[model samples]
Target: MSNEFALNAEARSDLGKGASRRLRRNANLVPAVIYGGDKAPQSISLLAKDLAKLLENEAAFSHVLSLNVAGANETVLIKALQRHPAKGYVLHADFQRVVAGQKLQAHVPLHFMNQETAAGVKTGGGEISHTLSEVEVSCLPKDLPEFIEVDMAKVEVGQIVHLSDLKLPKGVELVALAHGSDLAVANIHMPRVQAESEDTGTAAE
Candidate 1:
């Protein structure tokens, strides 16, 4: 939580297939773009290795990153990442430049803790199924959370966890809440034996 990775980059003027490929071959840098609000999208390049290391931590996806590019330092959040399917390498990333007071939407990673030894799993052999790993949330740059917490300690068998149930930071709003869809965030289901027992009990009555 305390460590932040900063990357140095320069604005890219020459673009397209030939320019990008040439950049990759000559500099080992990948082409990227940054945009948001009233600002126009700018072409940029980042070191592929540094980007890979950043992706290893889920926090990097949503946390405010200090991007030093084009002779300017910009505070931005990662919006999307494109990877080479076969090589599993980062090809491009989309960054949304943030203004201090403007509201921005970033996909925050979900942290699941205390689920392994929960009562549902220990006593009832419940299977922990997660429907979402990261949740999109809107908030000011300063109000952005490092990650969303899903408490499995309170999750019992047959219980469903929804985005509305999350305890978010002040001013932060989950994207799912506005949609009004009953998306299953997660569920605890009993093992086969317990399921069969309940089925037998119903059949007898």
Candidate 2:
């Protein structure tokens, strides 16, 4: 899947709780900063409402972003986001600048499709299970993907779809694999109650 979205940001000179509150109230802008790639951190502000709208899509959190900060533009990935706890509005965001030449670690969402129509789910008394929602992957900025598609059509009861089994984008690699944790992205399993009843009934016989 492909998406092209842009974030418009402005340079911000003032910082601190009071200054941020004033900026939010007066200008309706949210404070943010950009860092990474040997460049010093730059303080900036993004259009609050626009930023909120962009974030509504799950891809926005994973895909590389084109940020227009004042007159300078940068390709970056979202490193972290902070929000107003009570109001649930975005207060600040942290951007990790991406360099075209270097491989960067980006979080990629996992999209599982066609599981409901799977043969296993239809006749094997199986249910779809999600093990991993997102994964950290490394790739070049130009090779970035919004998400990785995991097909559950082949998944069967008692079977697991692991990280090693995922088909990654070209030049992309998963970081979670090195952690030695075999990440089960998804699985189709028989209903717990049904399995238990079968086991108990078989044991009694």
Candidate 3:
């Protein structure tokens, strides 16, 4: 998370579908835009190979990025990415300018640990089911976490983990919990096959 991701881009004066298509097909560049903050939105293009490489790392999605556009470096967050439906190639990207001390919403991935050693899974013969893989959090850029870890070692069978149960980093807050949702994040339960087998055994007895 401490590593900085930098992409070199160029200001694109040509606008429209035709222009973008030429940029991608001819120059091997992907169309992109930078907006938000006090500055007007700027159209730009990035190398397709370079962007694909950066996206190979999962942390890039949640990490702040430094975009160097024609010698000017700007701090931004990846807001949206558009890819080809069938080919799965990145077609366009949207970058949002971030300011210091301002709270922004970003989705951080969840990392579950100790599943095999959990009381429910080890002793109670239960399965761990993850209801959510990521959650939206509201925090300043500096306080943003790359991923939230949920320890399942103490979780018991039939127990559910909710948004309120998660331990948040300082200055970070779950948007759903703040909005009174308190949604379920994960749960430990008997597998369907085991449950069915137990029911059949009881009926036979």
Measured by lDDT, the strongest candidate is: 3
**For model 2, what is the C-alpha lDDT against the true structure?**
0.86
* Per-model CA lDDT versus the true structure: 0.84, 0.86, 0.92
Clash counts for all predictions:
0, 0, 0
Q: Ten consecutive residues with minimal summed lDDT in candidate 1?
A: 1-10
Give the RMSD in angstroms, all C-alphas superposed, for model 3: 1.6
| Candidate with the larger TM-score of 2 and 3 | 3
Mind giving the per-residue lDDT tens digits that candidate 2 earns over 1-205? 1335788889888988898888889999988899998899988988898899989989888877889877677888899999888989898899999887898988888888888877679778799889889999878878888889998877778888899998887988888886776687888888899999999999999
TM-scores for every candidate against the unseen true structure: 0.89, 0.89, 0.94
Model 3 whole-model lDDT (C-alpha atoms): 0.92
How does residue 48 of candidate 3 score in lDDT?
99
- Positional deviation of 1 in candidate 1, in angstroms? 12
**What would the per-residue lDDT of candidate 3 be over residues 1-205, giving only the tens digit for each residue?**
2344888999999999999999999999999999999999999999999999999977788888989999998788888999999999999999999898999888899999999999999999999999999999999999989899998999999999999989989999999998899999999999999999999999999
Model 3 spans > 4 angstroms off: 1-4
In the range 1-205, model 1's lDDT, one tens digit per residue, is 2446466677999999899888888999989999986888999999877787777877788889888886688777788878889987877788888898988888888898889887678777899999999888989988999998888887888899888777788999987787776567888997778789999999999
Candidate 2 steric clashes: 0
